[model samples]
Target: MPGPPILTSPPKASPGDRVAVLSPSFAAPGFAPAVHEQAMARLADLTGLTPVEYPTTRRLGASARDRAADLNSAFADPEMRAVLATIGGEDQITVVPHLDPTLILSDPKPFLGYSDNTNLLCWLWTHGVAGFYGGSTQVHLGPGPHVDEVHARSLRAALLTGERLEVTDPDESEDVGRDWLDPRALHEFGDREATEPWEWAGPPKSVTGRTWGGCIDVLQWILTAGRFPADPSVLSGGILLLETSEELIPATEFGWIVRSLGERGLLEAVDAVVVARPPASSLEVRPTKQACAAHRQEQRDVAIETIGRYNPDAVVVVGVPFGHTRPQWILPYGGSMTVDGVSRRIWADYA
Candidate 1:
């Protein structure tokens, strides 16, 4: 089958434009109003864009159809320039089927999210619409004392200013943050530690391609549900984005998932693979700093070995901060990304 049509970033949002904030997966904002409110205020102050929330945005346990209604309405509205997910959750797979492709295809706009939001992103990709792969009001904007600089830069790049920006290591990260119910969750970050440099593998040549893929766990569900392309060639020459969520699946499991992609011809179809820094700890279980480091290293090794088996020439960069981690760098989904092994740098084009 032919590859997807060339995807384009939606028109950039102006300072005073309205952006929809919807909870298409889980209504995290409803559960933690304080964090959600703070995120809203910060969003307006930072970008000068108005955040318009739909009824289901704050209505927890909303049916998938109801959530899809909000999304459809947002896309159909002439004034809404962009749509943002409150956060990722388990049920977006159900929500995606209810979405009206005509609404999105008619006015394709940037939708920023990751994790479970990958379902929507993948759905949007199928229709040839581009979106950002990271950004969560509940996770990145609300709980921290402030939005991390890397996040702020990429957020603007995705929304207000369409520009090419280097994807950088923030040099520190946290696996998870304070409990949402805790009052301190409003002004504090979770336990954070210094980060290690990203590990580069495969050939030394630089490769640039439009990006595809998302949280590996979510990709599994998408594939099992028959939502992905019947022909892996749709991803031909694209950069594959891969990351695990806070569930902290074992390195072996990650390898298994990649192995499946390899069997399906996806691993060999891509020119490069970009792996986000996987979160190694969660609220219920916090490992020692040393243990966390070891855990990340294990995943890094598995990713390198598995991808190499399928495509030894595929450029691989592991442990870049983009998904399921604090200080996350929101990257382009279905937009241009350059993985330069020679320069040891990465660049994402929000345009």
Candidate 2:
């Protein structure tokens, strides 16, 4: 595939800039006020910017049309420099169809989100605009003591500046979640362990292409919706970045998603792949750390096997760190990504 050109948009955010935060999918904040408040406060404290909220940002069970309207308003608001989502929800794909394509394309601004927000990121790219994943105030911004250093740095670059984004190896990584009930748990319920160097396992050489993909579960929705997300011609040689959400989809299901991508001819069309650490278990499953890690590794192994079978020529990098992680970095969707398998890092260049 041809290299993706840098997309066009205004410069990054400055201090005191206005940005809109909305819940386009599920309103996660409704159930957890502490996380929601902390995330909002952090945005102001760290960025020196005011976050404007819309009607449904904290309202769960919001209609898809209502969420879509909030998005359009945020994009159309002359004063707002950018738009952000609180966090990703399972049903963002439902909002995609209701959105005004013309309005978004004509008045595009910087957007921040990941996970289910992948629907929006992919949509923006489909409409010829760039989107940023890895900047959810709730996830990156926390009710805990502070934001993760790696995540904060990345959020800064992605929101206010465009620089050489470096991928960092976590000295310690945690696959655990914070407890919403016990304040003590909120202080520190998660576990962290030593992290190995990122593994890059794609082709024999380096290749750069546009970046795409999101939480494997959400991507599945887009694929099943049966709408045209991109021009097939431009997809040739694009780089695919993918990760599973904290919901901890089964290993067989993860493999099935990759196999489906191959079925849809998406795997062969991309030059390389960047996979993130999957979310092992949510409160729903409440699996132990050992079980969570084991499940996640199994899913990763399944994805690796599928990619090998379907797109053997494609370059693949395992564990580059994004999606559902505390210190998530915003990745450029449908932008340039250089996969250096030897170096085990995927360098994403955004417009």
Candidate 2 lDDT at 301 equals 80
The TM-scores, one per candidate, come to: 0.99, 0.92
lDDT of 1 by residue, 1-351 (tens): 787567767999999999999998999999999999999999999899999999999998999999999999999998999999999999899998888999988988999999999999999988889999999999999897899999999999999888899988889899999999999999899988899999999989999999999999999999999998789888888899999998889999999999999999999999999999999999987888888888999999999999999999999999999999989999999999999999999999999
Candidate 1 TM-score over all chains jointly: 0.99
| lDDT tens digits by residue: candidate 2, 104-166 | 666677898988888888778766787777787766676466777877777777777766566
Error of 1 at 276 (Å): 0.9
> Deviation in angstroms for 211 in model 1?
0.4
| Candidate 2's TM-score | 0.92
Off by over 4 Å in 1: none
Provide the clash count, candidate 1: 0
Model 1 lDDT, residue 27, Cα: 97
Best by lDDT: 1
